[model samples]
Target chain A: MKRFFILSSLLLLFLAGCSVQHKVVPAGNDVPSQKYKMEVVFPKGEISGIMAFKRAGGNMYGTAVNEFGVKVFDFVLTGGKRCKLKNVTGFLNKWYIRRTISKDLPELLNMDFAEDALEYVNYRQNIKYKLILIKE
Target chain B: MKQATIIISFLLLSILPVKAQTDNEIIANIEKASKEMTSLQCSFTQKKQVSIIDEVITSSGVLYYLRDTKLCWEYKKPYSYKFIMNGDKVMLKSGNTVNVFDTKSNKMFSQISKLIISGVDGSGISDKTRFDVSFATKGKDVVVTLVPKTKDIKKMFSEVLLHFDVQGYFIKEIEMIEPSGDKTDIILTDRIINKSIDEKVFHIE
Candidate 1:
């Protein structure tokens, strides 16, 4: 019984440590569509791309393309909280990568931006995501 | 009748090889033009179709290339971004921040840089060692399809098609098809070849 309790406690700690936590607020009512220059940095390297987002009804949909013009990923942010990845490039379809993107992008969508340009940065799962507003 | 039949057979055999020879000649002419060209300035329109979202995004940009190895690809519509490749170095500018990378140190970037230059200059498209190339003549355009022979490129792109004008032997359009059925088509227009492009255009800062 003691061993079981200790193992359960350790497992809980591990799970908590691995969880993705980001402070998010409700998205503002602004332009219906925008474009950003996105960069995703991992320990090994960085991936640069362009992201286009459109808000319709209550959900925001985004698609990203690499500098070489390859489609990187597509996602939908619902209610400024729920982020569902619609598709990911074959090169970045790993489970861990998907989890981090799904967790971090919603928080990014919830943040406010300047009228002309602004930079937003977030860190999750040992990955850095930066989005710079380029167009509205 | 026997002599006439033999002559007809010989004529058909001679005509059959002409198409293959024409394809090779066209490729050679493009290579020769690329070799002689020193610089090029062009405007391009890129259209990407996202299969998952069922949407099409259109963007326009300008491309500048200097002989040997210098290129600047800049996006001006809907958003602003710049990619410049000078020799073994690459620079990317987004908003206010700029990042520089050494292509020699990064294999992926090195391949991409070379691919862009070759695609624009029409030099390496017919590389028998790197790609399985096929040609189809349609109207005044000769479409060259290149299937990647390397696993790394094959993983990213299923095939690439380059459309060249027969009269000028210059590339008109480039279509890259991904494995997931998504594709990006870039149409080059307002092309001015062998013109003096300012060296400052390729400057990193």
Candidate 2:
């Protein structure tokens, strides 16, 4: 009875450890190209704009504009890995802004991560930024 | 009577010198007229063309300028956005969000805004250090072409053209051609000049 009790405890511990380990899932690559109205909430302030994206030959090209119809930025993502920022307005031409947007784009566009459709809310550095995709 | 005759002769001689400089007469008159302009409010329609993609985008907005420093561009249709520049500070508002920053940190924006303000007022075109200016006449319009001399400006735009109405000396259209063959044309209409503009309109809270 003593041996059996020890064996049972060891099995429980092993099972618990296995259950705590997380499984990593790769994002889906089948998301269709579409236009989305993006709103970014930062620590200083928030900005809303329209983004038009097109995927061709496994590459993504995008252009964004402010509500005043001013062109903000144009970028290209090749093979889902390499990123090239073609043009950007002076106010948003910072390194951190570019890095943050690049990191969050895939997740926001539903190209990465398995999640619900149409809306995504992400938190970074205690600031919450949300992206809502509207179908035209 | 002799002293009065001498004074009249002196005035006529001064006027003759000015008249002899006919090449610069139009620009001088424009500069003189712009000095009296305190504020201006106008509506503008802008059309941008991207040659690579073969796409043309059109937008309309209202523009406000107050003498030297303050300017505002507000868009109402399709969506609402505001860009206000007051001295060294710039503010942009879209929807409920407002982003404010100092223009000193952004040299490119500062330079561009300054050029726009000067261009609208029709005074900076004579700055030979910045642009090579040449004038031409096209029917009732006086067309002025400015080719950028600065490297930073030349990298973005090849040339800028301003069209003025000869009778009123009012700017009617502005065209900017980019190095990449893209062009942006802005047409200003319904202009009201030298109007009293409330100072509160320049501030963005």
Candidate 3:
């Protein structure tokens, strides 16, 4: 019984170390306009884009454009919980891409992640992506 | 009857050679002009129409190209982004970060970039192996339609049309039609050819 208990404790510790902890904070009424260089590395290939985030009237707005100035996605985050995609490219209009963008945008722009944080790294199975906020 | 048939065949054969000669002459003239160009700078206005969404996106940018494979496409309005292709390397800069990739590693990007470079210098119309080229006239503008022969390009674009002014012998506009009926038209203006371009313009850093 003691051996089984020690093994279970070790398993729990291992899982805890792998998990990311995020602290939720209250939504702000306005967030300053900020620009970021967003890079997404997927299984098939990698795509990089410029993202501009702005907040006005308690709603968050974001626009992402590729190197060719082609619009990839434009979305709005309302009340910090619900995400509304205003316009998206044909290939990225699917549910999975929308879900990923909706989740990532808040983490990159929200007050919950802290303004001083310059880098956010995310990993899902074999796919990994990093967002580096550019200071101008 | 035999005499009439022979005459008809001769006329048809003669007309075929005349059409081919016209195409060759046009391509030769474009090539000769391209050879004299050392560098090119121009401002372009791009309009992308997405038929599915019924949306038209307008953007304006500057394009710089150097002979022997170097190009910098910088978009300034709406959003700022730069794509610099130097030889086999491509650098993309957005905001303050830069990403570098080798052309060999990304086949699709390499192909698209090649198309853009060739289109700017009028070499794409001469590449008969990759594309089927035909010429037409719309009013005063000379239009060259290029249909990709390869499956890879056909998947992305249905056809590309290059419009030139017969007087200037330079490209004035380029239009790419996609398989989904989406079209992107780029109008080039304020062109400076064979001008001295600073080498620093090609560097992303």
Identify the leading candidate in terms of lDDT. Answer: 1
lDDT of 3 by residue, B1-205 (tens): 9999999999999999998887777777777777777889999998766332233556678999999789999887555778899999998876786778899987666877978877888888888898999987788777889999987677667898998777666788989886645577889999999889999999855
> Candidate 3: where are CA atoms >4 Å away?
A1-45, A48-65, A69-136, B1-18
Clashing pairs in 2: none
lDDT of 3 at B65: 94
Question: Model 1, range B71-174, lDDT digits (tens) per residue?
Answer: 99998875677999998889988778798999988766676677677778897666778789888988999888988888767766788888889888888898
Ranking by TM-score: 1, 2, 3
How well does chain A score by TM in each candidate? 0.68, 0.60, 0.62
Specify the highest-DockQ model's number: 1
Model 1 Cα lDDT, one tens digit per residue, A10-54: 999877655411111123434434767778787777787778777
Which candidate model has the greater DockQ, 1 or 2?
Answer: 1
C-alpha positional error of residue B73 in candidate 3 after TM-score superposition, expressed in Å: 0.6
Model 2 regions more than 4 Å off:
A1-50, A53-61, A65-136, B1-23
What is the TM-score (0 to 1) of candidate 3? 0.65
Instruction: Write down the C-alpha DockQ for each prediction.
Output: 0.11, 0.03, 0.04
Cα RMSD (angstroms) for every candidate in the order listed? 12.0, 20.0, 15.6
